[model samples]
Target chain A: MPGVLDLVGIFVFAVSGALAAVQKRLDVVGMVVLAEITALGGGILRDLVIGAVPPVAFTSVSYVVVPLLASALVFFWHPHFTRIMPAVMLFDAAGLGLFCVTGAIKALDYHLSPLHAVLLGVITAVGGGILRDMMSGQIPSVLYDRQLYALPALVGATVATALWQQPQLHGVFVSAGSALLAFGLRVAAMRWNWRTPRARGVGD
Target chain B: MPGVLDLVGIFVFAVSGALAAVQKRLDVVGMVVLAEITALGGGILRDLVIGAVPPVAFTSVSYVVVPLLASALVFFWHPHFTRIMPAVMLFDAAGLGLFCVTGAIKALDYHLSPLHAVLLGVITAVGGGILRDMMSGQIPSVLYDRQLYALPALVGATVATALWQQPQLHGVFVSAGSALLAFGLRVAAMRWNWRTPRARGVGD
Candidate 1:
């Protein structure tokens, strides 16, 4: 079910956040806080914009528990965890894909414009990571000129949203296809060193 | 009216955010985004947690426009704005006082516990600045061990929430008095260089 996939996504994001904490040398409390934020921040932002009260992350104990568990795991064995960074990034890409489709659907359900819904989907995919980076005192990776993160999310969300408007397409199929597209694109971008052009004379 | 005062507070916060953007050498778009976030981030967080739908920041045109205007003003003449930084900080403290009381009252109205209401109050006062700092790639001033920013907000919010629970006190008086107390405390802290104790052996 979509709910189960969402949890999986949350878990992956939480692990990434915990790793970021390890890198920053933050306290145990900081690790847990960062994990929670990285897992739930985007969903919370999406729900708030679309008027979903007591956001799913807030209302569901399972959502809170999963991220905390991820944090605890990383806290106890971060060295081992860091060794699996490549695997984590792949899962993070899947989460990004799933969130974009789901977030777009949710926004449309709330009667937002197609453009707005797409934007919200991208936000739901990238907002958490942005918050995580900012909390760790770094410029968000999404803002980096060389990062191709948000673009793929935007593409996947657009595809899903468009598919959603087609009467013949099943909802689950639409979501699955969108997720796969985004995940594959992200993986490709990583493998190929895809980069965005920086503003002229901006930085080295 | 309280609404008018809230706008003033927002304007001051937006100016501060714009100044931060100027320092960061962000483009006009960045300045506008930071301004909007800094002015409205706290209220948006408070509203989302309290289940206030379609946060006022998203709904109101003035809320959006005021910050954009502030960003424009600062983008063009940052030198003048920077010279008035002290005056802006004083107003920012007052705004913090007002927001803490208002945010607490709103949370209580939504049936949150006193403790949660007070926490929301402090968040509403400081969350914007924290977001602004993070967006600009800096550790939040609130997280600094020696900063006394949030404590005064906590105190004011607690006072307001307690007064709200009492049937005898006039609501307007309670709000005004709470704001005054917080404003006085913040001003005094600034004047005296009041410091909070850091964890032993933490970085200086």
Candidate 2:
């Protein structure tokens, strides 16, 4: 079930990446490349930092195939996608929620401290989008987006780690609750236009 | 000796990163962060890919301290440093040369294929600058620089790999020769304004 959720998250991320490529007027190859990087880059980065070489993204054919399919769908139907931007944003939030919980859990499995696990989880959730923006010659949205993206991931990771440390919590329930909490927070932030404050006296 | 060479490369890379921060007019905190990322990012990336857990950048005091020291120097003496830009470029080339050989050798130690090792080598040589560019909101120079940057690293990595495969070669001589070759190629390319051709139909 977790594996299936991961694939679904990757697909949504890939679609978003492909849309970015379209907006940038990139060619077909660029769209696919961006999609793959958006889908797999975060997991790859998390895995590498934790010494999980030959990361699951590299080993799983499904991980590769799902993103390619998502990219293709977006490439052929981006106008429809643009119209459904709200739905897409919802799915992206879900992806963030799922990734943070799973990334934190994986770090715990490697015996990392809870604090470090939380950090890794946030990185895993945001790293792909960061890479995508960088490749597109823009500042990373996570760094500059007024929306509370990384904060939600941090909260989700913290909750997940806390639950995991409990002596009697059911794993499935813990994961689901943490992910839903993050998803809810992200959705609320978007709906309410929750914005982080910029530094004082800093001119853009 | 190789350890010392790696530190030297890191220090130079960190200085370049700090210089970039100055150009961008980033604050001191940003300067230090950029410098650390530039000096250690490539090696951390290389170590992660090769399953070297707790990367040397995280483990070694020197690796952390050198970049901090470099950042401080750049922050205080940037005007003088900028005036000697040509010499700095030469040093950057030498750093590139050293890193490519060392990175490839490390990858080879992990028993990666020679081809994979060479690729890692080039990545290690250029990855820090790429990160610095991306953080500064520019396209990675490796992707767009006209004056043949990655190519020289490629040549150096390939030479080092091939020589390492030879049964009768001395390790020290092979490393020195490969580094010199890469350094010389980079210098020549800059002197002659050698450029990799852009796609004919691609508009800048």
Off by over 4 Å in 2: B1-36, B54-129, B139-204
Instruction: List the candidate 1 regions with Cα displacement exceeding 4 Å.
Output: A1-44, A48-105, A111-122, A135-137, A143-204, B145-147, B168-170, B199-204
Chain B of candidate 1 vs. true chain B, TM: 0.96
Judged by lDDT, which candidate is best? 2
> What local distance difference test score does each model get?
0.85, 0.86
Identify the candidate with maximal DockQ: 1
The CA lDDT at B197 in model 1 is 83
Error of 2 at B40 (Å): 4.0
On residues A26-118, what C-alpha lDDT tens digit does candidate 2 reach at each position?
999989999999988888888878888789998999999998898889889999999999899999999999999999889888877777677
The per-residue C-alpha lDDT of model 1 at residue A111 equals 67
Show what share of the native A-B interface contacts model 1 retains: 0.26
Pairs with steric clashes in candidate 1 = none
The CA lDDT at B30 in model 1 is: 55
